[model samples]
Target: MKFTTKWMAAYFPEYKGAADTEIPIHHIYTDTRQKTDRGLFVPLEGETFDGHSFLKSAINNGAVAAFWNKEKPIPEFVPTDFPLFLVDDTLIALQQLAHTFRTEINPKVIGVTGSNGKTTTKDFIASVLSQNYKTHKTKGNFNNHIGLPLTILSMDQTTEVLVLEMGMNHFGEIERLSFISEPDVAVITNIGESHIENLGSREGIAQAKTEILAGLKSNGKVIIDGDEPLLAPLHTREGVLSCGFDEKNKFVLSDCKMDDTGTRFTINQNINYMIQVPGNHNVKNASFAIIIGELLNMNQEHIQEGLSSIELTGMRLERITGKYGTTILNDAYNASPTSMKASIDVVKELPNFSRKILVLGDIFELGALSEMLHRSIADAISEPIDMVIAIGEEAPYIVEEMKKKELAIEAHSFKTKEEAVDILESTLSEETVILLKASRLMEFETLLEHLVEKE
Candidate 1:
């Protein structure tokens, strides 16, 4: 990012510094621990940690400048002539800088958001768009407020297409990110019971997710999951393209087939598509990318290559071999009731596994409906799953509900991951496929590691 020190004056006019020199800032950094060179450090204040405490470390680690909160006293460690963009809040200043940089570069931005498939869809869109354009997308799971700005600032000046993942837990969050991104094209993957605790119901969740349309460009197009009844309101909206298995969708999904390797599907019988990732849901995720690719005028061959060559973000159904010759589907990145069921459905479809084991943990943030949502996962379990190993505070309810329903699947529940591992390791075999999925707080990756290491 080539930003002049003088340019900072535009967003922060009160920025007290020499405005003559055009200093090029190569990077923008928040965490002092991460290695940075000639970067602008933006100190943020939070409840548990204060980034202002790390300013000296940031400067020592090669930060050429920083955004200084005007309310806070200037630290003495800095030289009198050092560049400090002064603002009321450093975090807001960082956002302002990113917004300014975005305007200067003026890349076509695509915003993607959903309860389950945001990361996968972002990867799909980026992979496909990058085949034809200089594309940059949200890195990892950094889709929140701070992460979104950081993503924008991190983009190269030459970037032609910018794909951003907009994530939220409550109202107004997506609206803030949408306004910040000013997306030329917006995609809402689906609205599910992700943050029912805060959003109340599926209707409320849908309301929160639709905030992406707030800052959508007047001429921008919208692609959505038409199968969702909650999204039916978007059906008649102008410039909105719907993609789903439903025939009512503009790009109808059809003839989906999946195995251990991947998924093959067709859209409207006009194009046949395949994804390296397995899941009917992932095929849905790929459908969003396909629509975006067409909107960008990318050719069919390039679009095919992009979807077929997808590399999903870590821990999202990542395949790994266990020490006992078991196949581990490490989807511990995150989980909502909807996502959990989707993962379970994918595991059910995989062929050649003699035994299918589902290691599910609690789906957090369900509010009053936590138990109900937890119990709903049991509905997805059947003969395809030989055993269900559940861990977490809410997991026992799953086992209880399954027993009540007499699902006929062997089930076990543990309050902690440590307790579950012993039984999990004992059951592993050459034909076993274990799927670990939970909320990020559960840290189920540790179980994945244990299974991978156990002989």
Candidate 2:
């Protein structure tokens, strides 16, 4: 964010005043409510509201300048001498400015995308690389079209490595992100049914995830999950690095073990590694980080140190103590059938717990196959699981399937999390370990709060 308005005018020549102004813009802001100090406000136009309306508010809040949409009328209150970059579209201008800044900084960019685990994978890669290099990564939920550009723009010029998470609900979204990033190393976590509502099927999801390759550097390397049959076509491609439990993968994860403490696994059958995060999926996530570390020429000791001291984003299988002395695995950040099963598997693996409870919720965006997909989770549940509390509109499908199986487990279905909370408040105890998981809309994390407050 060290660019000047003079530099920005080079890409966007149409400006109202003072193209040679020496204003150093250290921040790019979109939201007017946020504090904007020496910031350049880029007004984005949406279906419901136009950001152009907030230009004056942004300027009042410390924005040095703004990007004005040419289609909109200029406010008569504003002076002509005030700095404004007139563009056909403010959103496109923001992207163009971000691209220009990225080219100038010239850091080694890594783009991560998938149906699940994109955020965790990005965090893992950034943590490992930061041990040896000045690394910057996407913060918070900023991994989309606007988020990605802002992530790049937010990076320090001295950053040696940049890791960005790419998220998409439909086709071509990843392509646009990739084109902006031009990644030197692209990692596809795995193909799942996350956006099956819009993308059609697992095959369609795979195709959409592969769009990350659209802007990959000519000599870039691709790291993927070889265990997925949908990605089998990439097994033989040059510069493609595969990591998974499958033997065919170039970097195979073997001899795995997990507990409440963490997970231990071997890479390539010889190198031992441990990550603080639970679940086999997280172990696979660390494997991708290991590959990226190696490609960056980081030594094994440094990489292992990085892996052992991993800092993950919150609500991804995080083990927290409950008010009742029970354990709460707050993994309610997001859910897909694959991720929900993975989280459940982690719950089952934790030892010393007398009762393992799974408070599950709906997985969104499954299209017409939502019911069948929701029921499919039953295939993963087994013994050691004492109770299953399904929440949300589509979660009852899981309960129905569980009942049909007739397993020796208690199952209850609730239309809302509020109803589920009443049962959990009385049921949870010191020996209980409960997992809360669902899509972002379900807000399953609030249930964990209720458990903590009851005591």
Candidate 3:
């Protein structure tokens, strides 16, 4: 049982019906279509639909109690014996209940946010800490205002550490999530061009990401990317440990090396670590998790064990075997200029690929800078990259820029993935490696269906 209806009444005193009952709420849901077991239904109001209109469906699906908006008239179909906690706003009430539940459990919270790698870093921290504690973390992309609270409410009562991923596309979103989670440790992975359209500039993006500090515990430690000049101001702040490749960082990473198996790096010139993921950028991500483990008193052995066994979310540098023994790097989960370049660099460094191909697609949410940013991706392509297949409107600009360089590389542009599929399939071979990267909207993963080796 997550909580009893009697426990909820303590905080939500303005209620009707059996508020004193000991009925246990095992789930919390918003969608009435999904059947729940003794759930607390939260009817959220949006521009298109009102969840309150579907309260009857929620009750039919096993919602034993609900948080009702005081402004809305309760339906006559709701039984008098049904528990209803009247609130000014159901969304705010959901957040309040989550915050209270988090407090009651009192887990050591670690909040991770940044323009990139936040989800991967959250997984790293959770995996490492779980070696010595009962850990829970935000699942999938549930890092927004509503998702963060739901993630908190989903944790088990015995969770010793709760790692929360806080994501935002505009200002103040991170701050609100921070206040809700109240993390004991805050990690800023790195600043990048993601959501630049909404946040204005890289500086604006950095400022928005730093809002995670708003709800940090009084004595909490903040780990950040020391190499990112935008985050320099916090480098000298008390309890802030910077982790990066730069020599000046408190937890410096050096001697970085990558191979077919994984990456190896040394931190502070003494502690050696290895991770299953590729990319030098991930080395910096691993350091953040390492510091968190250290701060929480996890031993070096356990930390290394965690890093070695990380299972990343799909499409972030995932390797797949293609139809003709080709290696496909599926970094198509999402892309910003910074991340796209980083993935490209990883492709350039991998050993034994006779040919390297890049299948690039348009990046979204750049607003006025969309064209310029898409064109800039060409700067990361050079001699080692043999072929470039550009798709989507702005993505063709990358092929245009590559032409201006007058290199001997093969490059093509297509308006859609369907146009490029036959060409991409023809390039698959044992000696070739292809990297597919673009924004989430591109749905580039769909192309994998035609490329993957079938049993």
Candidate 4:
């Protein structure tokens, strides 16, 4: 059980009915459609919908208590004895409750933020830390203001480590999440171009990402990318450990190797590590986990075990066997110029693929730099890459740039994913490997529905 109604009453005293009852609340839910066990329903208001209207559905789905907006009238249907905590803003009340619950459980919080690999890094950290601790991590894309609180509130009382992936599109967002999480360990994966349109430049992005430090506990540990020039200022800070391929980092990575299976690398020229995912970028992400494991005094054996058995979120460099034995690298969860290029490089390095095709799509939030940034992806495409099938509005720039190179590779452009599905299906074969990448708006995973081999 998470907490009792009596326990929650201590935090929210302005409530009516059953305030003294010891009814257990095992879950906290927002969506009325999701069934819960003794849940506390939080009615959230959005642009097009108000969850307040569905309190009856929440009640039918096992919501024992709920937070009602003070502006809304107590519905005539609501039982007079049912617990209803009145609040001016249900969202803020939810956040405050989560903060109190987090303090009560008192897990060692780890806040991870970066342009690209925050989710993957959160997975790595949680996997490694769970080897020696009762760990809980942010689920799916639940890293925003609402999602982070829900993630915290969802954790069991026994959790010893709380791993949160923090995401943002503008400034001050990470600061708000950091303050809510109050992490003991803050990790800045790397400074990339993920939200350059809103943040302005790589430096601005770094500033926004580093807002995770705003709520860091005194004497807390900080992990960062030593290779990123924007984060170089923190290289010498007390209790800060930098991890990267650069020799100057506190935890240096080298001797990296990748193949069809995964990546192998060594840290500080002594400890060797292997992860089931292939890419130098992944190596850096794994290094952040290794540093955290060491800081927590985990044995090298457990760290290795964690990395070897790591399971990533879907649509992230996932390898699938397609029709006619074709290989599909679905990195289509989301994309930016930096990540798209990184995905392209991973495909370029893999061996034994006679036909390597790139099914590229537009990257969003690029603002005025969309054309130039899309064109820059072609810089990573060269020899051994047999075909480039570009789709979406700005993705055609990638093909246009490749055509300027006049290489022997086949390059095609289509305005939409539907237009390219037939060509992608025909190109699949035993020797061919295809990489699919795009922004979340592109819904590139739908393309997989047509390409994945069905039983």
Candidate 5:
């Protein structure tokens, strides 16, 4: 049964039931567009537009209930029959409701946070945990403040394990999400060069990621990346499980091989395992899951089997055939210099490629280190790439670095994505290995979509 108003009000004392004490909402929705019969719509504020304007349409589309800001005039379109979950702020109300749901649902929560691989790690853990239990995970990039709440509230009563990816950009964001989640187990994938603009340094980012522990279960297990020097100190917590390539890790990954298809590796105490993903980082992420599986007394084979199952989110270093028969490593999800370089390495290692091409856009949030970090990507382009297409303001520095190093590879800079795509379309060869690496704001996926369609 969907969450009734009764259980929601139990923990949310703020919840005042309908006139007779029955405020039944069949479903919850953040997007007004999806509002349907018995839908509780929470109108969010965005930078470009206010969702309040859409409330009328939401009800027209069958929204039976809505969370409206007291400031806005109630739209005439919504019939008097519908109830408005009135609040000072709709977002906070949604978060509070989700917080209440967690107390009621009591799922075995596994929260993951880090600078780089949280989503991948979350997916890996969910796959492994799903083998023996009903598992739910944050889908796509829904790991932010509002998204996390929605993800939590959506879990059913039967949800055995809920894998939540808790991502944060600034100080205390992870803390907020963690308090809402209060995970039974917390995983830190690694502290990488992501969101360095706002946080200032990799160390600062590490501190932000570690805030996941603030709301962790008192006896919860903390799984960390032992290979990351920045994260190594975090294992001081008792019952912490360290997983990485290092021998000292509780779950050590060795004999790793990465191909265009996937990576193969073996855990120290477990049989050989392979994951259908390209990167040592991914193997590390999967290793965390293997350790957790062992802790929960799950079938070891199922853990490996679970790792082998499940498709990852798109635009995350995905390998796909594109136009002109190009093999594209579409890594446009979001990027840092670290991830960009990793994708380059993955593409460079792929066999039988006639020409290696790196289509790199700007890495956002490097702060003062943006130029140096962008230029540093040139160092990663060793022998494999025939040409480097650098886009955005940082492209010039990347090209200059490539030239100073006396690399014979061709370097092209474009401020506009149109010119970049035109060059990619006309110059791309049949056997070229094209790697698309960029930040989410750069819209690199548009080029990827075009390239894929042309193929």
Candidate 6:
């Protein structure tokens, strides 16, 4: 339940008086506002403010241990009895400490990374593994430098499974995270145009996602989406399990059907499985977990039960009953061209017949190719969609282009989210099955909350 100065000294040799300093640990905190008894405080120094200023407040609030930068002066408020691990860089020390803790527990780690579906796939993997073992997963989007380490350190000594989601907008972020987490199995959902601004191209994204392989043992299994052109070429090798809809994939999903409740797909055509998540993407997401379950030696019944009614507090597509009997599909967790199109396809197939309305917000991080990718959503438009309400600045190109194509469906572009939400909530009818989709940065969840809200 605690990370001691004794263990930290092993990683940060610069720490002084380690033998005399008493390490007290219960929780980890970055903000002094929430500091409490036995908390290990990490002061993150950035361009704006230095964390050394908060050391006094953190100590006053009962923070017992801290990562002090050797570059800064030691605060007088720090009591003589307290433990302080001096580090050349506090953030790097945090990562090293997490790795030390991971080795201490030795949980079965599953490292997952991709342009999309990392969160969903993590949910699926954790849910399936929980069928027979104690599990802990990355909470929501806590899959970055700080979250990954916290996830590993948070695991109890008995935690049999740890599903870690690795995300990056710049290069080497995943590489650093992977070093801390030596996953027994690595899964890559797919490599897409996300983070294209920073990474440069789709091919570059593949390289960044492949960084997950850095910490993986040579004999450990690597899972990938075989249907992805970027990932397909690298599929064949020892200890690799490719999962997708393609025949070449080691695990294939076929005979897929989606209705109001869930998606049903057969794995390798040997076992039919059902999951409460919609979209063809969810089928692939669930298949990755099913493969993991098989590797863990679980029965089909366990896999089936685990997949059904899977828990994701707020992720992917979820059906909700709105006011005036309007049905809403809140895929507002996040969106990209690939996922936006996939969600549009799922909307096209929903059972209850109604006018399909799309409320889309701008997707960030696509870089120079942003406009073209934004415009690609136009190609995904078809029958069943009565209107497309485009919100945010970048998304308007797609909406305007759809107008030029004379596609004959209603399309509206708004510069602000509130303006778009105002239109949909008032102008849309009861027969509407609205789809709220956008990137996480857009805070589309706020707009989704307003439209089709059932009292």
Best by TM-score: 3
Which lDDT values do the candidates have, in the order given?
A: 0.89, 0.90, 0.93, 0.92, 0.81, 0.83
Off by over 4 Å in 4: none
lDDT assessment of candidate 6: 0.83
Per-residue lDDT tens digits of candidate 1, residues 1-455? 56767677666776544533577678998999987767888989999988888988998898877888887788887877678877888877777777778888999999999888999999999999999999999999889999999999999989999999999989999999998899999999988899899999999999999899999999999999999999999989999999999898899999998866688899898789888888989999998998999998999899999987777799999999897788999999989999999999989999999899999999889999999999988899898899999898998898999999988899999999999878898888889999999999999998866787754
Give the per-residue lDDT digits (tens) of candidate 6, residues 1-455. 56666666666766644424446477777789874887787888889987778888887887777888888877665666667788888888778888988888888889999988888899998999998999989988889998888777667778888999999888899988888999899999988788888999889999999988889976789999999988866677778899888898888889999887788889887889998877888899888899999999999999888888478757477777676677778888887788888889888877766688888889888878889999989998988888898988899988888987888899999989877766787755667788888888887777656755534
User: Which of 4 and 6 is the better model by TM-score?
Assistant: 4
Model 5, 272-334: lDDT tens per residue?
A: 988998777778878888888887898878987899896678877777877767778888888
TM-score of 5: 0.91
- Give the local distance difference test score of model 2: 0.90
Query: Which stretches in model 3 have alpha-carbon errors above 4 Å?
Result: none
Output the number of the lDDT-best candidate: 3
Please give each candidate's TM-score.
0.97, 0.98, 0.99, 0.97, 0.91, 0.95
Those runs of model 2 whose alpha carbons end farther than 4 Å from true positions after fitting are 453-455
Model 6: colliding residue pairs: none
Candidate 2 clashing pairs, residues 3+ apart or interchain: none
What candidate 5 gets wrong by more than 4 Å, as runs, is 11-23, 45-57, 68-88, 426-430, 453-455
The window of 10 residues in a row where model 3 has the poorest summed lDDT is: 307-316
Ranked candidates, highest lDDT first = 3, 4, 2, 1, 6, 5
Q: What is the alpha-carbon lDDT of model 3 when measured against the actual structure?
A: 0.93
Per-residue error for 298 in candidate 5, Å, reads 1.9
Instruction: Count clashing residue pairs in model 3.
Output: 0
lDDT tens per residue, model 4, 1-455: 99998999998989988866998999997999899889999999999999999999999999999999988998999998899999999999998998899999999999999999999999999999999999999999999989999999999999999999999989999999988889999999988888889988888999999999999999899999899999989988888999888888888899988877689999999999999898999999999999999999999999999988788998899898888889999999999999998899999888888899999999999888889899899899997898999999899999999889776789999999899989999998999999999999999989988887666
- For every candidate in turn, the CA RMSD to the true structure comes to 1.5, 1.3, 0.9, 1.2, 2.6, 1.9
Q: Which candidate, 2 or 3, would have the higher lDDT against the true structure?
A: 3
